[model samples]
Target: MDRANIIHDLLDWIETHLDQPLLLDNVAAKSGYSKWHLQRMFRSTTGHALGSYIRERRLSQAAQALRSTPRSILDIALQFHFDSQPSFSRAFKKQFGKTPAVYRRTPAQGMTEASPQSSAQQPNYHNESPNLHLLYNGKCTDGKCTQWMGQR
Candidate 1:
């Protein structure tokens, strides 16, 4: 298959399997490519390291869980495969600009309420090539906050 098609399939697989251990070796095996080659293709295609994308995706899901679930921060962190709460907090803060606890306690600006349904839905991701930037602007519309994916 072509590189674009291969990358698309890889992205889908990664999304579905986010809850599992997704090491570079594991993903490379799944992609039927050497780790080095897969990394090159992934970076050239997505403009981000394969590992970074996976980590960001996990962080994104963890953010949703934090917003909607009564689950503890540590539980959420563990669920997303972070090694520890402190590590999870560091990554979460780096990505979302708030520690998970603070993030849960303070509703996002312009967002008045959290819906359980939103937590069940997947975060918005597209199949386009090139880099993406997740804009968690907390801009609410019709009582729902939206996260936007933009070209980098």
Candidate 2:
């Protein structure tokens, strides 16, 4: 019915099937919006494009796999659908400023917080994260404020 609903529906599908192929048209169709309209809505409301959102989400999952599993960098990269190590490495470096090796060796250290400003949130956002709780317990009571769920 609205931009938030559109984005929420898209993200719900994303979370459930991160490993599956995603198409903008499919997402748009699911949300009952045109592809272009959904793209514009995502950019206007979230300030990041859908492609970037999917990439970030994939990277976040890759980082999590690196930390939680004994998998190698290549394995993690492949797990997130990245075709090659260099491509994955470049993206990982660009977003996180570290390679998979360094990140896996120490996930909590050398970590940078996603400023309330940037589109990047911490990559460790599995179900148990406090952020998930925030999403569940918080709401925009006024419907106009852009504040986060728990923030005042």
Candidate 3:
């Protein structure tokens, strides 16, 4: 694939796996490229480092979830692979200039709510699935666990 196609595929993969614990190695493996090469190409094509792109995307998704879902801030933070609520809040404020709670209370004008069909299309993490594993403190715990994991 060409550079643009590769980058597009990488982005799609990132979007599909946002709810999971994404790591550079995993992304590289999925893309069939070495980590260093993928990082360089991703940065050149997207004008952001691979890690930054992932972080920004996660924050964007978290922002959307904050506006659309009734889930708690900490739950949302953990769902997005953030280490803690404070760290998530710091990053959210840095990106959106408001905390998650404030954003949930008074979302910006352009914030769009996901339609029922779109929401229904999302994967249900609570469902029993062997391929999906919940990680806590770097260890895969029970499938039903929702404890905090370290940074992605």
Each model's TM-score? Answer: 0.76, 0.69, 0.71
Candidates 1 and 2 compared: the better one by lDDT is 1
Superposed by TM-score, candidate 2 places the C-alpha of residue 67 at a distance from the truth, in angstroms, of: 0.6
Displacement of residue 90 (Cα, Å) in model 1 is 0.6
| Top of the candidates by lDDT | 1
Residue 88 C-alpha lDDT in model 3: 95
Q: What digit string (tens of lDDT, one per residue) describes model 1 on residues 1-152?
A: 66765776787688789889999999999999999999998777655688888888788778778887899999999998999999999987786667888878985676422221233334335221124454432233332233344665
lDDT tens digits by residue: candidate 2, 1-152:
55565565566577656666667777778778788987887677544577766776677677777776787888778777787999999888776667878767864754433211123432122221213211211111222213323322
Model 1 spans > 4 angstroms off = 111-123, 126-132, 135-152
How well is each residue in 27-63 modelled by candidate 3, as lDDT tens digits? 9999999999989877766545789667766777787
Q: 19, model 1: CA deviation in Å?
A: 0.8
**Residue 65 miss distance in model 3 (angstroms):** 0.8
Off by over 4 Å in 2: 110-152
- Give residue 127's error in model 2 in angstroms: 13
How do all the candidates rank in terms of TM-score, highest first?
1, 3, 2
Candidate 2 displacement at residue 19 in angstroms: 1.8
